[model samples]
Target: MLFDLTDLRLFIHIAESGSLTRAAERMHLSLGAASNRVKELESRFGMRLLYRENKGVQLSPAGEALLIHAQQFMQQLERMKSDMQQFSSGIKGHIRIFANTTAVTEFMPQVLGSFLARHPQVNVALEERLNADIVRGVAEGTADIGIAAGPVQGQGLEIINFSTDRLVLVTPREHALAGSGRIAFADTLAYAHVGLHEGSSLWHFLSRIVSQSGQRLELRIRVRSFEAMCLMIEADVGIGILPQSAALRHSQTMGLALVELDDPWAVRERSIVVQSLDALPHYARELVEEIRAGQAPRAISPDRNA
Candidate 1:
């Protein structure tokens, strides 16, 4: 109950390694010391959290629950250390961010670039995840911040308006759908499509829409980036549903065309999620502000960024 940070850390190390000896070596502690520390924890809990046998140590139900909370504890401790360092001369803080593909591709580059320019001592680790995973990760303390598109049932998170992500139909300049101005997602089913990678959020979203349309969306090619998808579309491989910001930027240079999507879901809004802004480390707060400043708002919202 009154375990120090070291106890929690060592237990986590042991849980990860699944062996007392290996964990002791990793922690630079003797096997006897590690064994004693684990015994003390078992005494505190009044239960055996781990079962040892031939291969390695395995967690009981209690150990499994403790591992979850212990990981969260480590994340918070790291954030606390980063926050405290801000009080010293230089910033020297690291903020971890998990964001969906739209945020990473269309928004974060310039925002993070400007933030790093202003705060040289701060660093960031960013991962592109699905919108659902982004929400869950931030809520579970896996990351300090989350950038996701569409409405989030944040449970008590502070949701700040980030940006509007529009999905438009991109095609060659002479394609029939190119000059249609706006078209339903289902209408595109008859034509071949240049799709993003299978794991990408856009690809999943498009796949679902195409499935729901009850018509086959002929797949011509798959590319990793929006630019690549656009290039393939330009070469007449097929049409693609791409982010408006990306499609517009490349369409101008490649002389491609953009058509509005008739479905309401095609236009998505993004938001920044945090458990508590007031509780964030100072440098993290600054980083949030930097991202907020990059909000290229295409619509009005109650808490739009300044």
Candidate 2:
């Protein structure tokens, strides 16, 4: 009770930055004011919390103990606010979702529009991230929900199967491998590829596969959208791997051939991931239901491993 939220926050900043000057700047307080606050905290507790050094400050045993409690308190405060948001019409509820490229580019727009229309007071932040990053974000409570594809270990989390899709190789109509019918992903690495931008989840997935195969992708160009990649392929820039849904849609207008990938990993089961559905606020839960409602019809794959 001796230190207020502002004092605790300032202490956290100083502990993290290891500099009172930097902490003062972060807390928007003068150096003297920040020093007095720390002094008062120590005076109330009758213990030295930090050891001052020429360069910066180091936490004493007491300071470390306080830091742990302070961090937990801040996290609980955030959770409390989120839980209380649905009851307050004046406050806007916020949801953060991390998803794979396929979900972000192919499915989310339509579902999100409907969800936003229903919840006008709610805000959504959707970001594309790799499977690992998405899982980590959800686990760490950084993301309210995660949309991931393929097999996932549900350690301390809930996984809901939402849809299914396949990754297929796209090539120009006249390309040499266009008539192959189906090809292994490793074989495709022999040809030049039109890949997604490095930051895209699909790009990260493909790069990991290539690394595991001990081969490298001969990337001719990088694009941000499936349409762009298809256009590039039509222009004979290079071949590419794309979600079958996207490739099929583009093949109608572009000179692109969709060839099935002979790899088990190509057949992906898109899933909704969260720490716990019941723990989410009403608005966040509603968004999850919206995504589930937009599920694609399940596709049968020949590969048992799919």
Which of the numbered candidates is closest to the native, going by highest TM-score?
2
- Writing each residue's lDDT as its tens digit, candidate 2 over 153-223 gives 76999999987878988889888888776899989888999999998888888888989888888999999
* Per-model TM-score on C-alpha atoms: 0.76, 0.77
Candidate 2 error regions (>4 Å) = 1-4, 7-18, 25-93, 281-283, 297-306
Tens digits of per-residue lDDT for model 1, 1-306: 558888888889988888989988988999999899889989988998899889989999999999888888888788777678774857677788998777788878988888889879887889988778888888887888998877777898888886688888888878888767569988887899999888787888777776887778889888899889988988999998888788777866785878888999987877889989999999889888878777774522211111
lDDT agreement of model 2 with the native: 0.87
Clashes of each: 0, 0
Reference-based TM-score, model 2: 0.77
lDDT value, residue 297 of candidate 2: 56
In candidate 2, clashing pairs total: 0
lDDT of each: 0.82, 0.87
